[model samples]
Target chain A: MNEEKKISGIQFASLAFISRIACAFTGIPNLRTNLPTSDRISVFLIGLLLSLLLALPVLLFIEKENNRGLQNREKPCPSGIGRIILIFYAAFFVGAGILAVSRLGVFASGILLQKNNLHLFTAILIIAGAFCAERGLEPTARVSVLLSAAVLGGLLFTGLCDVGKMKLENLSQPFAGNIPIIVREAFFEACMNVELPVLMLLAPQIKIKKKTHLLLWLPLCFVCISAAFAVAAAVAGHYADLQVFPLHSLAVIAKTALFERIDDLLASLWVSCTVLKTGILLYTAYVAARTAVPACKKRCFFILTGALVFGGYLLLTANIQFFANVLQSAAVPVLFLFATVFIPLFTCLKNGRKEHKEVAKQ
Target chain B: MKILAIFLCFLLTFTGCSATVGTQLSNRLIIEAIGIDAQEDGFLVSVLALHTQQSNAANATETQDSIGQVFSAKGKSLSEAFAQIDLVSGLVPLYSQTRVLIFGKEIAENEPMQALDFFIRNYTLRESILLAVADAKASEIIETELEKNTLVSKNVQDILESGKNNGLTVAVELYQFVNRFLDETDAAYLPVIKTQENQSGKKEITHAGIALFAQKNLTAVIDKDAAKGLLWTAGLIDNDLLSIPFKGRTLSVAVKDCKSKIRLHKGDIPTFSAEIQFSCDLIEYNTDDTLLFNLQELEDVNRELQKQVQKITEEFIRTAIRENGCDCLSLLKKLRNGQPAYYAQIKDKQTDYLKDAVITVQISSEILKTGREVVKPN
Candidate 1:
């Protein structure tokens, strides 16, 4: 459909990095808002471990598949496993794309736009993402590098300036109240960060490095987000849990010498991150969806992919919390089963079947 | 085609989207201070707004007509009350510039739930608004025109900042107050603003003391002196002054810095203790001791000043802890952080534990500049 473009490991890494931290702007996973110091720390550690577990399979797959993700043109599977991989990747991408839009919709209603409905911003976001998706994956990854800077800048600015307001004693409970909830929250949170699965689908087009992007990316993301979580809890204290949008409230409360109303400024900067996150998910879906139609080109696939995601968002926008619940309860186990378990098992079976056929011919 | 594109660009810029345009400023009223009073059925909300366009108008104006207007409205809910103000004045009331929230004594004494819900839910209002308990009806504070060239809001904000910086009262922003209400300790304090009649019969607002709250309910109103003690034990001191009577000569010095390190003891019973260290610079003195000019006199004065401060602070602490049962210094929080196991043991019985616990006040002071003691025996 389009000429193959090889992207560097860092650009690929940057896309994954932005996708992971962008979810944190609304609320970081695993860390409870305004929780006791010890419990917060424990939740953050558990979330980190689960993400690493899911990410390891993708790293191994990219290395074993000779830097190709799902886009290997040379190897064709018997028993129609290629069709299965393509359809599964497509579904996962579409699911992630809708989740990002819905979360942004729930957060933006009456906060940034100062209106009761988020349709305007959500529609604009979908259009911008579709435009980016039309340009293909490398362009989205390149744009991600810029979006990454803006997102991190806004996050750090609000987090750093609220130092005077921190009340450490508010977060002094050094022990968790409930272990089961902590573990459950951590498991649900790992799936919310959909970048790991997206990376597995795109590894073929990327120039694989000996030390993959996850090495530097994961710790950077965890450190920055964990710092944000801790600062938000320390500054907001007992008021943290009461906030509907915790980070937005933190931004609303924080002020510098020259700038007040940082919430508006940061929310505006987040528009770019939202588009990039949305674009990457939609682009991944396009790569797999194009496999089904022999005559379908990349541009048509991109348009169809955008149309389906936009329709899905329109239908699901009314119940944002429903998608959030589905993500935690169902999405994590299913994504792990496919990305970590099913994909590897099927690929090995197909490879063994091919090797047996060649030896019999000899 | 190019001409059509240029025409479209010209059409697009027609409906401008600037928030601070000159015309819009006239329709928007910037409220700088708000006063809320409880009534039999509804609430009386007073607003001090900056008449932006009128103030900027070129005219011969009197001191009383300097663009600050106080408007009052009554309604069941805060939103309804504010909307009524708009209906009466026809100008949109913008709370973004509001710096102070004055609560009538009656409302503060009863409960602030109705007003607090509106404030916390409103997206336009900032959490940094300084909350103060008015001495009488909040409308009186908003209505009393000050003999200044500024709005009442600016005056109140400056006074509150000065008092907070000088350790005269605690700095309680709306966010901090809400946080304390949500805290497990269930105690917080707000500065009290009182209107005093001067000799000329002019009424002016002044800082009286602090109003203590236990989970949104008013518990006690302590004076400024007790609040200063709370500051001392909490290590939040700014510009403090101490006058000492040392061997018949009064030594008054400006305190440079006062720091407190508090520790909570846990065992048979949990106890709270504070060790305060202060350094001062001599500003003025009326003494006839020649030793006052020497280094020994400086050491003696420092020691006596420490004793006098210790006694004053101890009295304030006793008033807060024993009399009112208010944890003004957040000793409970310190216990939770510093000693968790002990905190767990006494989380349920914190008030009783504090009552039985021993409180010790230790002060050490150093007088840096004992201005040249050139006064010989008069």
Candidate 2:
């Protein structure tokens, strides 16, 4: 007597592309300048491919589960899939939230607000996002769509404003840094961008039926990648090899009669993006965990762990430099393995079983 | 009830922390000048901060001017010195608008790198703050009173900027200083300012020369002539006067647009070829020439002047690289960043390698305009 909605193929691709672009833009600038440029791009591509592999199995199985439920018609459908999806969502959401909030929050303080005001302002934003997520996924997604547009617009406007500062000759030599350095650097950058597809944990729920979905999502991902790369490449140039943050350095070069310092604006944008990004990831963690285990109350868990997680974030982030080193060197490799390895392995097993069941029924 | 109480406590704490001060305490302090001198133990820091006072209109005359307080302290560390000085001053010293950091000659020569490290490490200090070496003493230079010393900071700023109008002095900022110091192949130099007693009883600041440092350590001081030579190599010479004898008469031509490039080559011994191209406008002439000169006359003058500039700049580079072991031209950094393999091999033996390096200078000139043709004084 009830109609259950389905997420189409277009929606899946949209989720994949959007996730890729958002994460990539956030991390590539940091990765390119500090580490070897070669390592930066290489590691990012590796992580991205790995994420795709991990995501494929889960995507196909979800499709299979839908097909199986339709075919049976008589037997009650298994209720455990939501629980499994929820578990993946939980780990992903929390890990991403803690990482993004703690890392970007510190950087935002340095770039935007005065030192004393950084913590207070960032904490206010995080609290607001956490409260908003409590309302549910629909509101979160709607807000994300609005936020993502605003971020993209801001990025375009900033790029256009700073376009005159760009010297084309700076990017003359591509991958000028050492090969080993580039690979290491690429992995560091990839850590930032590749985690985006983790939003696929929400794959089962989005209503992506329209044919126009693929057209919308695929180009969006490319545009995000292009703009971020352009910003890093143009700003750093030959001097990029020397400085820590080339994009920020380029932001310093921005001179307009209206404002002498545009780096402050870029820093503010980073803060806003980080906030929405953390909120989405945190919600995903809740959803994924709830899907995997029917007995667990996901939203309640979010509420319970909120203060503890925040406290942990504070304690762990005592030393900003140490936190950055850990994020760049340790956290990225682990994230790459999970997103690229673990998910795919599980998906293959689930798909193989579903195939076996289909043959047996036939 | 407990949760409500806890929330109320948080609210009260947050509200209690709200400040009423219109401006931050740090903003109140206006640090005009910073003097760094090396003592027998460590460093002697002297800071000139703004001292504000309220004057009654009855006492205030038409020529009422603003005056400032100068505070000095010595400590083992810069932060410690800052803390010591802050105690004596009513307001905290703010360095956000700090115009100059003058280093005494002894401190510059003995431990220039250490003084640079202190500024680089401080987050509050900006990279754009001008770096200068005091010819005599840091305190003496800051205390020197000049004509219309109403805005001493503005006067110093104008002097440094005017250096760009000619090639007499070299201007270096904290960022540029640190950048060169950190860069293995390049050296940094700062303008030297000295206090001198003129004909009158007044004390004045004079630009002595440029203090050249190798690997962030002061190796030697290049006098005015040598500074002019170095500026020629760096392509920073704008109003340089070239006196060339033609037809047994001396002609002075002022340099206008200029470009310099040093290309490095390697063989049994390393070699560097320097190319400088510039345009000049005739400013003065000994002969009373009423008519405008043709292209050939200008070309001849240009060729002779090119030879003169090339001879000096080439000599300067050779002496700086071979004799002094200085890399102030930043050619080494350019080479290192442009070619890593070459840098890796020659980095250790840079001074030795530079001695063996052959340098050639080539100059090209284009005359833009000659002075107003003084009609023959008949």
> What does candidate 2's lDDT look like per residue over B1-378, in tens digits?
436423532332231112212455444567778888888887788886654441223443343454455778898887788788888775655665577889998888886877777676553555457789888678776665556424455556556656766778877766556555655676678888887778887776768888888866788787877777788887665566778887678888888776776676654444577778888888777887534566677777888898788767866776676788888876665556566677778889888777776678878888787877632222
Docking class of 1: acceptable
* lDDT top scorer: 1
| C-alpha DockQ of every model | 0.29, 0.15
Cα error, candidate 1, residue A7 (Å): 3.7
Residue B245 CA displacement from its true place in model 2, Å:
5.0
Please state the error at residue A172 of candidate 1 in Å: 3.3
TM-score of chain B of 2: 0.83
lDDT for B357 in candidate 1 is 62
> How well is each residue in B1-378 modelled by candidate 1, as lDDT tens digits?
436433432332221122223337778878889999998887999999987766777661653566788889999887788999998889866776798999998888887756787887776677778888887888888887777456778877877877635778766788778878767775788888877889899777788888887656778888878877777777767668877776786767888767777777775566777889888887776765444455666667778888877876887777877777778777888877777787788888877776766888888877777666442332
C-alpha DockQ for predicted model 2: 0.15
